[model samples]
Each structure stands twice: as structure tokens, then as C-alpha cells.
Target: MKRTFLLFTMLTTPSVSLADNAVNVVSWGGAYSQAQDDAFNTAFEAQTGISVNMVDADDPAVPLQAQILAGNVTTDVASLGYSDATRLCDENMLMLIDPATLRPAPDGTAAVDDFLPGGLSDCFVATDVYSTIIAYDESKFPENPPDSLADFFDTEGYPGRRGVLKEPRFTLEMALMADGVPAAQVYEILSTPEGLDRAFAKLDTIKDDAIFWEAGAQPPQLLVDGEVVMTQAYNGRIFNAAVDDGKPLKVIWDGQIYEMDGWVIPKDAPNPDDALAYVTFSTDAQALADFAMQISYGPPRKSAASLVGNYKDTDIPMTPNLPTTAQNMANALAFDNDFWVDNLAQLNERFAAWLAS
Candidate 1:
């Protein structure tokens, strides 16, 4: 394929200047970062003779902005969610990235045209599309497994502690979904006061029994410890737990909230040229497909989809595991970055107050 051919050529040619010899990347750590390390960083270093340093953060956008505001920018590139990437770009906190710089598809599709909707932007070129899904410990629900989003809210039907993310973004939308809102209408309803109240009210059904988790890794741990029977978790995390670690967990794809996450350069990165080089190489179709094989996240490039095959070191097909899979996406909500960009602060404050109450 042209993509792999491009990767092979680039790997052999080593065009990036080695003067800086390093690029610092901040991302959500765990299996996700490991995938990037395996598919991008390691290969990037070998390709350019430049060292790749990985930094962990709960949200890369936070530290990314802090570094810029402090006028001591250390990070070269960051993996950020769609809303953060959009907002940071609008605020001029991130460097302008031209889509033309990205590698085209093997079939010669332009990068701008090949990237999935919301994947290519002024300062962001998405790598993957992942989702927040409910994962239940199979040992906990042997008789009658919880299969739907509404089941997550049915405390009496499946009574046990529920693990929820400690944020309004996915949690509120999920609450609304479990309350019977259509996937397509979630953001529309969420944009209204009545819809907001309805979502919180649904959440009230299990708020007292909810165990909140801030990090992606916590949900699986919560299930393993038997602290929560089911949890809202990043789908990739649950996949890693079950396949990589032999955890007795099963993902509930209904009402899953999927979103794009990708690379952004800080406005004043320590190695701007090198950062651009790394981003370009890493977000290419071949690199994205390789990353997807390492984890369940769906690659954003249309060309990458065909390149994706089985999970790394396993016979399990990766397509079925991806959030973009037809079956998984049937009832999924494409997380509304526009809504979050506008209402995140207000919803966060409200969520905090609700938690206290």
C-alpha cells in the first residue's frame, strides 16, 4: 500500500533534523500512551534518530495551557480532546497546523478530505476516535447481565455501586441517554435547561451509590476490587483489562459517547520543527492503523480503516472493538464538542454543586 510504502521510505530516509534530538509529548497515560509509544514514538525515534519523551497527564490540555501561560513551554506536542483542541486553537494557545502538511492516503486522498468529520482542524489532526462505555464485571452479573444504558441507571434491578467519571461531559450525556433521550438529540436536549434538569434527576437515581473516578484507569480497578459492579470507562481501558489482563469485564456499547482525540503543538514549543515532524509522521494513515491495532480506538483516517486488522499479538479482529464499528455505533453518540466547548465551565460548576449536595 502507498501508506506503508510512505512509512518505509520515511523510516529509511530520516528527513527530520536531529539538532534538537528529542520531542516531549504529553498525553493521557496507560494503554493509550503505550499504544502511541509502540506505534509512533518508538518508530519515530528509529526513523529520525531523535529521542521521544512521554509525559503523563489526566488531561494534556491543562498542562499544555499552563506551560504556554507560564512562558516556559517545555512540551513539544500534546494529545487533546476535540473540544480542548478547538478551544485552545481559538484562544491562540496552540500553534497553527496546516492540514496540507499531513501525509495523504495511499490512494492519494488529501489529508483534509480523508480525515473523518471533526478530525482535521486548524490546529488539530485527529489520530483516533474512542468512546466512553459502560463495562460490567461478568462475575458480578452472571444471572442477568446489564445490557443497556438504562440498565446502568436501574439501581434496584441491578443494585450495586455504579462507577461514574468525575466530570459533567460524559456523565450528563449518559444520564440523559439512560433517561430515554435519542443519541442524535442528546446535545440538543443538553443545551436546554429542562434537559439539564432531567439528566441530573436521572443521575439522582444512583448518585448516592455512585463511585466517581477521575482517571481512565480507575474504572477497571474499581471493578476488580469489587467496589463497583459496573462503570463508565474509556472503551480502550476495558479492552486492555479483559484482553491484556484477563479481567472478567464486558463492554456495554449502547449509548456510548464517542469523540476524537489527536495531536496539538503548544504555541511556543521547544522544538517546533521537530514537533511538526513527529506529528506529521505519527498521524499518517499507517501510523494511525498501527496504533489502532495496539488498542481498540478507531483510527480517524478513512484509509487507515482498511489498513486496520487484528489486535496486536492477538487474533481478535480490531474492527469489532472500535467505537466506529457499525454495531457499536448504532446507538452511540458522537460526543458534541461544540456543546462542551460552550458549556463546559457552567456544567462543571453545576456538577460540583450537585456532588456536594
Candidate 2:
């Protein structure tokens, strides 16, 4: 397996003791990392005096797993997708988190009740909800745009290469959705062999015209470079490309799949106490809302939802762009982390085989 090197550091305060005054945190880079740094790390340092060394990765799970197996746990706390957190916890690769340690909502609600359903796990505490949505270059489809998952798969009508992430997770979910499977029944249908075949069969429609992207940055770039007319992308990345970079892009919220990203500590972290403190502070309602103000991600706390109204430096309402918003949630799939945890290895094996065939 290839390892992602996290090559960055933050030395805001000049006095940090290597022995007990520092903890390392890892996250995916780009605008999302900037949001976390602004929302959590700096304030965390100010409150606790534990200097945070910020590390960046394509996917934090990759290097985190490497550190766990190699027995040199340099990352004190790392942000992870729910499935990775659950799977790693099952394998004893992550430290089990106790929700009791977390600070309650400002209204005096308990941590467990304050977080979104399924947001708390044995080893991780959720930070935000982000989605993988279909986006197309608006310049390519000014008159007739891709409005649905079916449009995304209809290359004959849309008439260009489609960009998809090079992974089984969302690709399989999307193929199933495009095949007319209801969002509520995706996992139920995927559990059967016939269903898996059906999803693969649906994917075969655009297989020849699809360009697979391995990184989050590639999808919007593909759209911008005119390499693809439509692609699956993280909403924040596409939003930044459109608003910040001035790329003409349109997002299709139909059949979007949303999942949680959260904080988890390694079982043998050097600074476990500081790691817990940071996560507890970072996931509180205000802090999560503060994160949304910097990026388009949806804060997972119900209280935080009300606090998200406008993006920083722009008058754009962050609500409509969020995956958890009422409008977007109508036809969305709340990613079944448990389903993926149980079937990922098997499905991934089949997906790899099918790809090579």
C-alpha cells in the first residue's frame, strides 16, 4: 500500500516542550484543513497550551493505519471517515473513545444526545457531515445541464467523459442509485449478489467514457480543464473551485451520499490526554459551527446547524450548500458506515477484479 506523507507544521507559539506540551493532529489538506486549523487547532492551543503540529494527507486513514501497524504512533489524533474508524476500532488499531469525556452542548445536553445519530462510536467522535455530489462544468451545459444521477450516467445525452472517484465506496452507491435503486434501500439491495451485479452492470454503461480520479482535487480540475463534462466530487472542493477559483460549475444534489468525518486517537498516542481535550473542544456546537463558516461542510451537531448561515468573506448562505440541509436531504443517502464496514473488503476485492477484467 502507498503511504501519504504528511509534510507540514505549525509553530504559532515558540515555547513547546517535546515531552508534554505538544500533540500531532492529521487531516486532509486544502480548504478543509484550513477550516479545521481556523476552527479548532489555534483555539485549542490557546485554551490548553498544548502546541498542535498539523499534518496533512490525501486520506488520514492511510498513514494512520501505517503508524498503528508499524508500532510508532506519531499522530496523537487523526480525523477519519466513519467506516475507517469502526473497522480500525474492531481491529484494536484505535483507542476507544468515551463520549462521557466530551463537553456537552451549551444548552446542557449530554454529548451523546447532542451529536447526530450514529455520530458517536466506540473509537471516534464525528466533526462534520460532507457529501459526494455530482457536479458539471456550467459552460458545457448552459442550455441542458445534468440534473440527476441518471443524467450523469447518460453520456449519449450529456456527451462527454464522466469523472468518478477510483474507489468502490461512492462509485458503487452511485451506480446503484443511477440504476433506480431508492436511497433507503441501497444497502439492503447491495447485500445480495444479484444487487452487486446490478450495480456493476449499471456502471458498465459509462465504463468506457469514464475518467477515474484518485484525489479530491482532481474532479473539479478535470471539469475546469475540459477533461470531463460531469464528475462526482466533494461539495466543498467543487464549491471552492466555483466560488474561489471562478470555475463555472453547477452541483446536482440528487442522489448525493453524505458521511461523517471525525476525530480518533491512536491506542498508543504520546499525548492521549491532550488529544481527548482537543477533540472534545473541537466538536462542541460553536466550534463545529465555526468550522462550517470557513468551509461548506455541515456541522454534525443540531445546535451547530442553526449557527451556520453565511460563509466567511461571502454573503452566500451556507445552508443550501450543506448536505444535511432539508432540501438536499430529500433524495440523499446517509452513507451506511456499518454496511461498508462489513462488506468493504469483499466488495473491494470484486471491484478490483472487475476493473482489471
Candidate 3:
């Protein structure tokens, strides 16, 4: 069950007309970008005679917003974080996705059921899954690695500097988990004001020993330079750092926060139909698996897991980051994007205040 998309770029011709036959996509820049460029962008063009103009972006939200507000919707499809997608949805800045047009299952059912609940909505569909976990320098902690988030904050026992993401969502959840809340109860505990305060109080205990990482690429560098023995990081970036530098690093999947990025169609997009086709094609099981294998991000498509090869006799599928097994994924928490979307500004302000204090 491979999902295929036609990708064509007008490389040779500078003045190609895209009015009727092309789709414009905007996406984050990284290995993910390369994989999409290789798999979908190339294939889509070869098959459909439709050229794709992919706009590489470090932050696509502002540009997308500007384009939409200006009534000059150049981007037909976009890959955005859940929060960004929600913001666009709330602003009525995106078009509703029609799941009926998606590739059908072997049983003749719509493939929409293959996606995780809350991972997609009327206006967006999840494209990839990434985890934020405790990544440690394996060389430094060769004998005994930190097994869980609890050990990450156990300074007296581990006895080293640690790093945590500067964002409040995962950081607060990690703090709550460290304070002994079970993985299943994390979100329930943080939904109330008292619970939020409790998590912050627990975080305050580790504040002095924790180095706050503000950027996605910073934690890996901090780990490589020995600035911190353990830090919270995206599984992909840490894995890339380790493979690139030949450094020994291990990710503790226990209590990891699994977050997803989604494909969203901007409101008033020039080619909404083609954008829908592109999204459906990109999420096909085979294409999803191919992209995941090239990058560390996991695909939400149910069949994508089977496409991954086995590293050993273990049932776990081999990926660039740690294997995403049923057990590992079972304990993983899905970050609440709705909560984050509603509270990001205030929570970020509070986080900054807490950091300064």
C-alpha cells in the first residue's frame, strides 16, 4: 500500500505557466524537506505533468499568514506544526479537507480511519510524528544510561548538568512525570490551575540544575560539547547529530512526548483541488514510509510501520532514531495542541518569567 504523488519542477524553463497544472507547497527545511523533494516532488511531476513549486521555510506561519491576509494566496499546501495549523484554522485561514478523495483501503473503506484520532481535523491531516525525549551522550554514560524522565531529573543520583526544553508544555509534563505522576495521568493532572501550579513547583526544584534549550538544534550541540550530559531533544535532530559527528548518543523513549506536524491548505489557495490531491498522495502508506525511513519522523499512516525494516530479531521497526515499538509508543504522550494553541502566548510569557526569576 504505497502512496504515490507526481512531482514536477520547471527547472529548465524559467517562465512556465502554473495557472492550471501546478501546486505550490511550503514546508520546513531539513532532511524531511529533502525526502519530500525526492519522493513526492519528483514523482508527482513525472506522473501528472503538473509542476510543484516548493517554498522552503524555517518558519512558514508568518509568511503563510501574510500571504493569506494580502489575498495573494501563492501557497496551496503547507506543512505546519499542530499549533500553527490550529491558529490558521481558528482564523478561518485554511480550506477544509475532503477525506473522500483520499486513496481507498483494500476493503473499499476510506483511508481516513488509518489516522490517529485528534491527529487530523476538517482543515488538516497529520503528516509526521516526532518525539521529544531524554537524549544522553552514550560515551559519557556508557555503563548506565538514564532510562526515563525521572532519571533525567535525578541529579543526586545521576550527578550531572541536565537540559530541558524552554517550552512549557513538554517541560511541564516532564516535570510532572519526574514528580511521580504516571504517564497516563500527565495531561489530566495538568488540565487544572492547581495541577499546573504543582508541575511548576516541581520544575522549580530542577531549575538550578537544568539548562533551558530555546532552539531545536541547541540540545544536540550541548550534548556533543559535553555542556550537558542529558537534554530533552527531538529524536530526529539528536539522531542526525550522533550519526553525523560519530558521537555515541542514546534516546530514552520512556515518557517521550510524541508531537505531530500536519498538512494544511490555506484559505483562498490558488489551487485548492491540487493541494488536496497532493496531501492525499503524500500520506499514502508507501510514500509515508519512504519519507520516514529517510528522515527520523514517523508516519501516522497505520501501514507505514510494516514498511520499516527490522534491525535485529526484535519486533521493533528500525528507524534513524530509536525504534518505535508498540510498547514505546504506548507510553508516549501526545502533546495537547489545543491547550498549547490557546495558551502559548501566556504560557511562553510565564516560562520566560520563570526563567528570568
Candidate 4:
């Protein structure tokens, strides 16, 4: 395993130390955060002797921006979606992260060259690429399972409540796909007013049967509790349900929407130094690989791919389950950060009105 050397003073153990001596990381909770805690936080604290205060958020970007706008940024580091990172960077709410400062591949390859496209942006360094996929409890569909995005909206066919993310981003994209828009054209269509209306129309079909979820952990639990027979969820959450919790859940990759999630430092971070160190260490090749092994997300660094062997503590190879795998990408859509960055606020307002209607 490769480790990066950081020139920071350390403590032997990670106790609740002074706030200024610790790194406060905000991230999406559930299995994804657990994976980070296990693979990155534990190892980060051990190596640097700096305490890590990991906190949960439905979407870290929301509170991150809120805090920044309020001029009371308590968060040192945050895990954010690529679009959010880009948007925040544009608004000057985040610190600029130089790719050259990131730890490079073990073979001495430069960090800028080793990271995948869109992995190392001005304000974000991607740790993993995760997908939003449709997963269901197998027992709910003993005869015929939902295998495509269309089936998720087919209330009469699937015949149970569907789990929908409360946000407009993934929901809008999936709505278009279910309406027969090709993955390649989702953004082009969404770039227009008619396309947005059409996508919402498709969602209207399932709105009555849709059970909304805000947190990453809720989808799988909704499935286990029989509240939602089929639901849209982060692939890692469903992977954990099936592999770790031994739930009889199945993921449908047919219309998966994949995107990179990574680290960002608030411009007014209380502990900028430790935050940078944590981001640097956690996004290194070994750290990325370790996190991916614990979850199904694909590590963003090319070197991390070779380092990723199997799911932590299991013989299951991590590659096949990754969103970047060939079979999974067959009908996949890469979430369009550019489009979302431009129209999120407007669409979110529209979505709110639609929900209330």
C-alpha cells in the first residue's frame, strides 16, 4: 500500500482534541461514510496523529454552501458531488485545490496525469465514482423484477411504492430515461424547456406512488421494511445491503447515473492545514483503493484500479461491481455537471412546486 508523507504535528491517538487541532469532514452518511471512516479516517488519524471529526449530511454541499454564505464556515472539509464542487468553486465559496499538491501514483506519475477525467478539478479531488441505481428487494418481485428505468415508473406493473430521491437532479435525469430518452441525449433534451416539462410529466406518472428519501441510507431500509418494493439509491448503499447486511436486494444497472464524489475545503475553514492534509492523504492511490474495496464505487485514480483487489474482508472482486465497469456502463448516463450547475436552482424551484401540486 502507498502512503503519502505529510509534514504535520501528530498525536498518538484520536481523542476529542481541540477544535483547531482536528479536521472536520462532512459527508453523506450510511455505508458510504462508514467506508470512509474505516478506510480513510482511521488510517488518516493513525498516520498524522490529528483527530478527525466526521459528520453526516444528507448532501454535504447544501450545508457547506449555507455555512459559507452565512460567513460562519465551521466545516473544514466536505465530500461533494462534482457539480456542486464546480458550482461552489465558481461562486468562490471553496478554496482552490492545486492538483500538483495531491499525492501521485506509486510509480511517480503526476497526480494531474493519474486521476481520471473530471477527477481533479480546481476545487475537488475525487475519491470515488458512485452511481445512482434502481435496486429492489428480490422477494417483492419473485416472478418478474424491474430491470429498467421504465419499470420503476410503471406503478401498475411493479405494483408497489417506488423510492424517489427528494432532490431534482437524479430524479429529472431518470425521468427522461424512463420516458425513452437516450442516455447520450438526456442533457441535450434537458437543456430545453420542453424536455424539462416532458421529464416532469413522466415523473407525474409515479408521483402518487413515489415514496421520497433524502438520506443515502433510507432506500435500502425502505426496501427491507417493505415500504418501497423498488427504489432509486446510491449503488454502494444497495451493495452494502446485499453483501454486508445479507439482504436479498438486487441492483439494476440498466439506467444507472454515475458521478464523482470528492473532497473540498471551505474557503474559510477553521483548520485549513489539517483539512488539506486529510484531503491529500484520503485521495491518494492507496486510500482511494481502500475506500472502493469497502464500497462498490470506483476509485478515481488509474493507479488505484490495480491496487483494488476485493471487497474488504470478502473474496468478492470490486471491479465487476464498479459503475465504470463495461457491463454497468452499457446503458449508463454520466451525470451532467455543467447542465446541473447552470439550472439547479430554477429546476429545484419547479420541482418544489410540482411536489406541492
RMSD of each: 6.5, 5.0, 4.9, 5.8
| Candidate 2 error regions (>4 Å) | 1-21, 57-59, 62-74, 341-357
lDDT of 1 at 158: 96
- The lDDT values for all models are 0.86, 0.85, 0.75, 0.86
Name the weakest run of 10 consecutive residues (lDDT summed) in model 2: 8-17
Model 3, global lDDT: 0.75
The true-versus-predicted C-alpha distance at residue 354 of model 3, in Å, is: 3.5
Per residue, candidate 1 scores C-alpha lDDT tens digits across 36-106 of: 88889877887887778777776777767876777777778889988889889999998899998999999
Off-target runs (Cα >4 Å) in candidate 3 are: 1-19, 105-109, 310-317, 320-324
- In model 1, which regions exceed 4 Å deviation? 1-22, 45-59, 70-74, 268-271
Counting clashing residue pairs in each candidate, in order, gives: 0, 0, 9, 0
**Tens digits of per-residue lDDT for model 4 on 1-357?**
232212112211122233556887888777778888889988888888888877777678877777777677777898898878888898989999998889989999999999878898889999899899999899988897788888999989889999999989999999999999999999999999999999999999999999999998899999999999999999988888898889999999989998898999999898999999999999999998899888899988888887888888879998878887768888999888778768999999999999999
Please identify which of the two predictions, 1 or 3, would achieve the higher lDDT against the true structure. 1
Query: How do the predictions measure up, each by TM-score?
Result: 0.83, 0.85, 0.87, 0.77
Q: Please give the distance, in angstroms, between residue 326's alpha carbon in candidate 4 and its true position after superposition.
A: 3.2
- Model 1 residue 285 lDDT? 93
Q: Clashing residue pairs in candidate 4, if any?
A: none
Candidate 3 lDDT trough over 10 residues, lowest sum: 7-16
Ranking by TM-score: 3, 2, 1, 4
User: Tens digits of per-residue lDDT for model 3 on 253-348?
Assistant: 888888788799988887878888788888777677667766677877676677755322344445545435566675678888776767788878
Q: Write the per-residue lDDT of candidate 2 for residues 229-331, one digit (tens) a residue.
A: 9999999889899888888998899999998999999898889988888888899899999898888888888778887868887888888888878788778
